[model samples]
Target: MPSTPGAGQSVPGTAVPGPGPAWFGAVMGTGGLSTLLQLHADAVPGFATGAVVMLVLGWVMLIGLGSGFARSVARDPQEWSRSVRDATMVPLWGMVSMGLLAVGSATFVVTEARAPSLASVAFGVDAALWGAGTVLGLATALGFAVWLISRRPAHPLPTWALPMVPPMVSATAGGVIARQVKSEAIRSILVGACVVCFVVALVLGVAVIVLAYHHAWFRTPVPVALSTTTWIPLGIIGQSAAAAQVLSGPSLAGLARVYSAVVLVAGAGLGAYAVFVTVRGFVARMPFNTGWWAMAYPLSTCGLGSYFLGWQWASLLTVAVLIAIWLLCAVASVRAIAAPRHA
Candidate 1:
């Protein structure tokens, strides 16, 4: 997933010549920022415009990055299998589905304009992307689980949770599409699918996170390069909260509220710790890699839960933190492009 050459002794996720799936993190993160800004649109009207711009940016990134990755796969079909076998890079496969889901969900929130003329088109687009993302997400989750069990990775990396989080992304994204679907029968099916996806993601993510924490504590210190992934757990936590909150209307409101409340409390604490570690790593000169983009979606997802819970301040605070990280990542990604060795 790194921007390095295909053949290299650098870290597994360090770099490759063509665009890797991890590059889709740009789209995933941009969509997250757009959604977070939209959450603050009520308090700051100007944020709505920014949200639209972010959505457009995400779309552009999806197109460019998707093409590049597709090209790489076409040119060298073995690269896909190579990446799958590379433990460090395998987790990034989840980003491919999640990136698509990000744009799909944001299409409704930011790009739709909510005009009557656009509803049908937006619905079609969201449904198509949601279907594609959800299916791909399921495959990624299963594929990663298979790899984990058979290979039995000797040490746990926080990025190990990356592959498990896409189903949660699917769950939350499906809730958005459910809102747009007109038929009650179809909506019910979507809701059920969301719940199922949430459970799959949460259960699998918990196992990975536990192992990651255990490794972080009882094993050796996490590499400075991988420090950002320490924050990856927050991605599932916040996404689960958002999925529950979004399900409140169609499901049990009180139960959903209570679940979201508990997850939010946990997210607040974990998020604080994640931010500290990220800053420490940055101060210690963590080089710019595709891994740096790892922080964006997880941090931005915390805002989703906060906004859904009507915690305006908490949501906006996440936006502030995400903005800072985004600025650094934006600059670093460009630098990485200019010099892959730095990646």
Candidate 2:
């Protein structure tokens, strides 16, 4: 099993790798942009338009990639199985579920802003996506952990956290939908589900994160190809914080919020270091792989988590940073289209 992701993928020129892990990250990031915009649209009306545009674009990419993967698999039936065995690629499969959750949440947020009357419809979309995403997310988190443990694993890297993140995404997104639904019975079930996923993701995710830390601290610097994935850990921190805060039901809400606050503040210290490392990476001209999309969705979670904490100023700063990341990704995409690269 390879330690590195191997190839940058022909994101524009090929179909199979076009649906690569980071490709889905683009969908996640775009949908995440919509969530950020909807959160602040009331304070700055200009964000509303971008919110809707991003919402639509996110959905388009999601559906487009879904179809692309379908066609690719139909043409080469072994592709899915191949990806599953590819150590460098398998962990990143969590992006599939993350993309679904991102788009689902964005759908709810945009509808809440522009079409209140359509909340029911939005709920349907959100709930369906949540269900699908949760199943896939659980599978990725649990299945990958088993796969890693059952075998002699390669050295740990930040990307190891990728497969662990979807449930955290699920926990946060599930909390949002749980509050939206009116049925007490369903709400109770959803909150329980959210809590279960939160704990599952948190325990396993943290262990992997700590081991990854030990690897970076005691071993070698993370290779340039996977450097962007340093931001990936933010997804776990931010989503877990956001999930804890958003969890409802009298029995869960208060305690969850308290836990959320503590993690949110502590995560900020590491978040700052992640940002510094990312900046220093620029001196080496960080390459634009799909992994760079980490700046989009995972980083946005930092802002989303802050907003849930009612830290508007902190959320705004995170948003400003993500906007720049978005532009850089756009430029990178255009450049990649013009000239594709391989490992």
Error of model 2, residue 111, in angstroms:
0.9
**Can you give the TM-score per candidate against the true fold?**
0.91, 0.91
- The TM-score measured for candidate 2 stands at 0.91
Residue 53 accuracy (lDDT) in model 2 = 92
lDDT of 1 by residue, 155-206 (tens): 7767778878889989988998888778999999999999999999999999
User: Model 2 shows how many backbone clashes?
Assistant: 0
Whole-model lDDT values for every prediction: 0.79, 0.79
Which residue pairs collide in model 2, if any? none
Error of 2 at 203 (Å): 0.5
Tell me each candidate's RMSD, in Å, in order: 3.0, 3.2
